[model samples]
Target: MSISIIRLGIDFGLVVLIWMIQLIVYPSFLHYTTTNLAGWHRKYTPLIGYIVGPLMLGQLGIAIYQVSTDFTFYHSLSILIIAAIWIITFLQFVPIHNNISKGRVSESMLMSLVRKNWSRTILWTLIFLSSAVQFF
Candidate 1:
């Protein structure tokens, strides 16, 4: 009903969608048999790249800008957590994704990678939730 509730709902929805893609769709598509992998990959990669990725980045940018202007406890903490998550994702997650694509990946490796990067995902989600509170 309120603006804060609407923003919270949107933020939660975005995070949930991303999590579903990373945790379910990606692994399913990767482990799919036949032409399913290619089909799903072609369909989803563009959506993630062109739409979801940019929107998430824009939200992060806004968070950063807001942090710069605010400089309070929660704002600083949220920015740091978000930045850490982004940095870890690019440095750690991307390599794992590349390895899997190159046929050099194992299930254990993928699982381990996900486990290691879980903190990043969790932290980013927290940052999103905390920042969304500012909308209220």
Candidate 2:
């Protein structure tokens, strides 16, 4: 398959994944007691990373390739947005996840995860839709 197709798939996958995490998984963190929360989060983090890490890396690689080659508006924007997502993931979300995994599962923190995640969720959705426009 073509690189563009692969990138679209990555974007689409992330859109779905982030939505689920934002709406379902993060909220569900609240259900776990504080004692169990850390262990559950620690386990969930690595497993989710196994899924999310590759897709995220793939998307970044694809975006970078696209930009380096033709450097079109969409390609450049896609890379910039992907960079933003990565920045948010590492700078913002990762810290929160680290905290959660340390058994610091507060309602406010959970809410923050949900709230901050909207930036990523919306960005990924836009990228997916933009890629779809390119596809069609």
Candidate 3:
């Protein structure tokens, strides 16, 4: 398959995974007890990272590669959007998750995490659709 096809597949997969995490898995965190919350979150972070981290890196790298080669307005715009997602992930989400993993399970923080995560979820959805339009 072509490189664009691969990028689209990766983008679509990440979109689906993030939606699931946002809608289902994260909401479930509210139910865990404080004692188990840390352990649960600790275990959960790495496990989910195992799946998501590579896909994210792949998407970012491919976006950069595409823009580097083509440098079209749309491709560069896509890269900017993808970079924003990475920035949101590292700057906002990771620190939030780190707090949670340390047993700091405030309802406000949990709510913030869920709310902020929508940035990634929505951006990934947009990215996938944009890529589909570009590719198909």
Candidate number achieving the greatest lDDT relative to the actual structure = 2
lDDT by residue for model 3 (9-128), tens: 999999999999899988888888877888988999999989998998999899889999999987888998998998888899888889889987887778778898899899999999
Backbone clashes in model 3, listed as residue pairs:
none
Q: All candidates: CA RMSD in angstroms? A: 3.7, 0.8, 0.9
Sorting all predicted structures by TM-score, with the top scorer first, yields 2, 3, 1
| lDDT tens readout by residue for model 1, 1-136 | 7533543564576577667765875556437643444455456555666765765676576567667776789867866776786788789877766655455655677567657756755775786678577767
Off by over 4 Å in 3: none
Number of colliding residue pairs in each model: 0, 0, 0
Model 2 scores worst on lDDT over the 10 consecutive residues at: 103-112
Candidate with more favorable, higher lDDT: 1 or 2: 2
Best by TM-score: 2
RMSD from true fold, candidate 2: 0.8
TM-score, every prediction: 0.72, 0.97, 0.96
Winner of 1 and 2 under TM-score = 2
Candidate 3 local lDDT, residue 129: 93
Q: What TM-score should be assigned to candidate 1?
A: 0.72
Q: How do the residues 4-101 of candidate 2 rate in per-residue lDDT, one tens digit apiece?
A: 88988888899999899888998888788988989888889999999999999999988999999988999989989998988888999988988888
- Shift of residue 9 alpha carbon in model 1, Å: 6.8
